[model samples]
Target: MVAEVFPLADIGLPLGARVPDFTLPDARGRLVRLAERLRTGPVVLIFCRSEGCSCCAVRLRAYLRALPELAEFGAALITISPRPPVPTLSTEDEHRRSLDVLGDVEQRVFADFGLRRELSGEPVPATFVLDRQGVVRARHVGVDHGTTMEPADALAAVEAITLG
Candidate 1:
């Protein structure tokens, strides 16, 4: 008998589930609340390992490149990591400046989202498309080091929420 393997995305916070509201500090030290942002429009919420992770950096840049389209759809992009934000190289700094990188220093928000890795307790990279009502419209939890939802898919998800 063969046991079917399910993707990690399927395990936590099933589809249509209303995400819990929480507050975390952004790069500039401003507290950002989930409910508050929801009042404006849908959000592309990303969970990443840490500010220093190379894979997470790549994922961040991908989303950064998609910012204009996301703005067109009236969806905000926010990234939360287990560690605090740090200064980066000049080239990367410019791109990073455009993103609202929140620090989940205590990993409380990660825990609330059920996004921690089983062995290391580090955050597993994930992307969640949330509607204005704070319900999760789409979610993609990465299976390993460099896996994550593509910007195109996330944009599509946001487009659905905006159009529907």
Candidate 2:
């Protein structure tokens, strides 16, 4: 657990609130539920626009590089998108395949989380940290790709929840 709490920017989901539970298919077409994953540890939900977005690629790659720190906290890295996981859409070279990119087919999951881009219907790049008990600890929501939270910020959130 993160003993020294770092200051947060702003989040849409209230702190300590329980988020909605839903199952979405992973890259392998396997159904994965948020609640089920919480059983193992905290989950860092990365709400990405698409593999095409350059900003998202940079942030995601950073997470990929920080896999060691994430594993220490027993946290899972999941990138969510409204579009289906296309085998051809290599968002950021080969390293992207290391991340679990799930598809929110109907976008109901995204809507449930209230993930929306400013002045656009697209989902904004956001990161949310949910503790093992299903309570949201911290989150960073962005209006656009350039403003999304850094991968290190997400890691900090995960550490906070896991250690707390």
Candidate 3:
């Protein structure tokens, strides 16, 4: 007998490319469209599994720690996952905890971004920094415990974009 594994999609968006539009409801069930969200400022899109994933948690902690500073750089952080809402915990709660972990329970955004993969029965991990115009400026995929995006790095990217 042979075992079969699902193929993984290339995680990160290519540099200097525009992010495709996607609309998913936040935990509050309000529609959040990427194009609409970016009208204010740049956006950091964090893609992960559930809140229980260790690496996910670590990455979010980094984002949480740097939220205030990242805001100074003029970026709106948001996250997505495929996990549906639960009884005790809601997607809104996830967003509140991290200010970036929006719920993508429908998997629409995952499919649109080519990040839909089953890496251990969980969604593939990825991140993207999109400018206000929705072009992906930087991207990282498949995180390790210590591997995550830094606010300083994002600030640098924003400076480069705005200056150029």
Overall local distance difference test of candidate 2: 0.72
- Name the runs in model 3 displaced over 4 angstroms: 1-9, 85-100, 118-122, 143-146
What lDDT tens digits, residue by residue, belong to model 1 across residues 109-133?
A: 8878878655566666788999999
The predicted structure with the larger lDDT, 1 or 3, is 1
Error of 3 at 137 (Å): 0.6
Off by over 4 Å in 2: 1-11, 87-99, 117-120
Per-residue lDDT of 22 in model 3: 82
| Model 1 lDDT, residue 36, Cα | 80
Give TM per candidate: 0.86, 0.80, 0.76
| Candidate of highest lDDT | 1
Clash number by candidate, in order: 0, 2, 1
Query: Which model scores highest in TM-score?
Result: 1
Rank by lDDT, highest first.
1, 2, 3
Per-residue lDDT tens digits of candidate 2, residues 1-164? Answer: 53432123432565777899988887668777887778888888888787778888787778778766776787877788778876543545335233467888677767777775334556656788889887878877776468765668778888777777
Residue 107 in model 3: lDDT: 75
Report RMSD (Å) for each prediction in the order shown.
4.0, 7.9, 4.4
lDDT of 3 by residue, 1-164 (tens): 65534433345466777888987766566666787768867888888777677777777667766666656656677777777433333445345432444577777777677666544434667778888899988877653424666767766776666557
